[model samples]
Target: MEPELFIPARALSKFVYCPRLFHLEQAQGYWRDSEETRLGSHVHRVVDRPGSGLPPLQAIRAEGWRTRSVRLSSAELGVVAVCDVVEGVGDRTCPVEYRRGGPAPGGGPWPSERAQVLLQILLLVRHGYRCDHGCIWYDRVRRRVEVPWTWEAEREVLEALSEARAVAERAEPPPPLKHSNRCPGCALLGVCMPDEINELAGRDPEPPRRLLARDPDRFPCYVTEPGSTVGVRNGRIVVARGRERQLSMRLRDVLHLVLAGPVQLSSQAVHALAEQGSPVVWTSTGGWLKAVAVPVAGKHVELRRRQYTTSPAQGVDFARAIVLGKIRNCRTLLRRNGSLAASDRARLDDAIKRASRAEAVSTLLGVEGSAAAAYFQALPGAFRSDNRLPAPLFEQTGRTRRPPLDPVSCLLSYLYALLVKDLTVACYALGLDPYFGLYHRPRYGRPALVLDLAEEFRPLIADSTALTLINNRQADGGMFEVHPTAVALTRGGRRTVITAYERRLATEAVHPVFGYKLTYRRTLEVQARMFAAYLLDEIPRYTPCTTR
Candidate 1:
């Protein structure tokens, strides 16, 4: 039989503290440093410094003592871990652990912390070293609490390790903890969302959903500008413009390959990407979705069943949340970036309230549509009049989707299309049926779920990027070609827009509900997975990504 991979010694502490958090970080690759984590690192620097060797332990010195970080492994326990500190006090070996907090009352360490040191002791005994006692050096109260190895403590640590191994081997995350104070300080809270998941614990566990990875590692690769070509070179996805090599990325790093207009893709490149299960999306010169080259991989058949049957029940609430979020964000953008007429501003404000109070999906949809009309009417006011473009070229009616005759309409249509592409990628990466959704009903080849998910992000990412482009007058009139039936961006125009769009995705903002900083692109993925978790009954309810 193959040997099971070793779990980190610190995982024992985290596993005992919270198994789901441990799984999210270790098993799922979702990590964000927190203040508590930062403080712990700072404290560890004092004790874990290299070449400094062991500091003079007033308690263990003068007795032929040696101390340093020790690594130990045991096949019997099927575990490998590093010991923080080992002390030699005249043939009596002891393991000491450093922590940022104080020891608990009555001279006993916290169960999780105790389990960690016990694991170290067990490993040391297996590694030909005498170990019967250990110590937890709590830095907060500046106290070192002595811990004697007992049968009960040994059993608890062993049982905890077994439980951790079981949890780690599972594909999906375990159930979340019921309301805890520690959730606030948890660095993974934004990704884990325990309260949201546990809220619906009364629902049955949909086992098929277990196939979904809690946090999949799928970053994006963006391409723009004409003459730029993508091809496979030496087992890497290389990008080049004209004859000069622009850059290259490992195929494994990319989840979605976005090829904006005029960007060519080699067949070999497509096959290589397909082998890695990455899709290449094609966009028009105006940034609208033209087509996509997705891999021919089989999906979870039952996932689609859940989407068709279980998803509709949640659609009303999800649609209301999305609509309310869209209106809220639209109002924010207008108040923050644009100068709206008094009446237009009042209409938007009223729309926000109505959308928030909307209980039915139809009511929410009406409120959202009204807000979009009011928002677009006020959008032109946000632009500078001193642009190189002819004043007539910039003039516009309220938002128009097809052909987009006016510059404002043209820019918005393109940007909204790009936003939809991103959300579609997010849904697919999260094992969701992008065509079927809670809010947007499945339409033949329409990707209604993508459209639905895009609603919440339209104002935050797309509209925000468009406003920056127009208000700054970054592109000239020559950048856009006005056709008899449609207006499209020229090569230079597409390049400029893609640059700005990429920048907007890279910009970090504090998540209003979770109180964490992540790029808008990351926020898009986070929100998508939150919805999937809810659909699979992993979380209690879905919360739309709404910014203040």
Candidate 2:
């Protein structure tokens, strides 16, 4: 028989606070560090260290002892915990739990904290040690709040464990708490997406709370210089060519490591990055996403199962929504930045209508194709006509890929590739199979799901970034190396485009549906999660991100 699943004592606390949060962290294996969690870890440094072992209850009664970081487990209770501190004296023992922040508003322990300590006390009692009470050491307040064990507290703990176990056994997480004040300070606020999910699910009429922060301080580190090596030294990622140091950045500040072309990363650096949950993305010389090195795949097996088992009709419905959103966003981009002609505008409007009405993926593809043709025909109007560079810089080459025939098409292809890489990483981080998709059929080597997601953002992100580079004169003709067969960006040109792309990602815009502003980078993850919610049937429908 399979052994019973033992719930961690700490997870009990989270389950008490928010069942969905607990489910996301424990069952789904989703975690993102925040300021509050960082501070908590800092405060836990001392008590986290292993200390003197605790003797048996008889020896403890005889000699009164104190131990730090004591590991305890109870098979009967199906619970395990690493108690921070345990003090004993003459047949009495107490578990002391450490908290980074102060006590609750009433100068008492929170319910979650109480439940955690109670479980710890129960574990001690089951192990033949007398534990009547537990103490919570609040580092912020510099005081201890005592929680005396009682029959009622024990019942509460047992009930919470039962509920948490049920939640774990289920394929989907419980619905989020309704407008609770507890969500703001939660470490998994971005992952749980309580407000956004509630609002989207039609359970809440109010707009989503703008709790997610804007652009994060950490940014992607791109290495484009050929023959350069990336390694870790003194907690910093160092890039060097030969014996000369090229760049050094604190490892903490790096979101991920991007290796373009022939860049080399040391194994030690790879191990360090993996430990920190930062993936290493490898791309071809022309920016095609080749592989991603992560410590492990995402743990949400249910979501992937749902993705692979989706019916063709449901797939077409989802694909239609995505295509409609993409076409609408494309029109919005043209109207906002370019001098869209009446004929081209009419064609785009008609295409959007047809795309919305399209029933099959083939029909949707046809509608999207026509819409893109009209959109790109007017895309050149978005460029600056007065720029004194070569006329080829601003010329409209229609939309060419693979071996782009002109500089404009070349830049667009490169930016689209970067966008693909970002979405692919997002898919991996969220535990979705990047190769499986609704709109785009699964193929070897292609991230079909990522491509499907990227369609809507192509105009708003990649195309807009390319336009910014060309119209602002940030990219000149010299950046391109034109060959008879193909056009590619030089190292300097790649750097320039990458900088521009990063800036566009960092730019904040109001989410059309949620009505809260977040960086485009953050929005991508939010959209990915929304897609997951849709697949799990938490939300009625998938809504692609469309900026106004």
lDDT of each residue in 227-316, candidate 1, tens digit only: 799998888889999889887887777777888778889999888888766878888666667776666522434344556777444778
Least lDDT summed over 10 consecutive residues: which range in candidate 2?
A: 387-396
* lDDT (10s digit) by residue, model 2, range 434-472: 999999989888789999999889988999998888779
Q: After superposing candidate 1 on the true structure, give the runs of residues whose Cα lies further than 4 Å from its correct spot.
A: 1-173, 176-219, 224-228, 241-246, 249-255, 261-278, 290-304, 311-313, 391-395
lDDT of 2: 0.87
Model 1 local distance difference test score: 0.73
Please report the TM-score between candidate 2 and the true structure: 0.96
On TM-score, the leading prediction is: 2
Clashes of 1: 4
What's the TM-score of every candidate structure? Answer: 0.63, 0.96
Q: What do the candidate models score in CA lDDT, each in turn? A: 0.73, 0.87
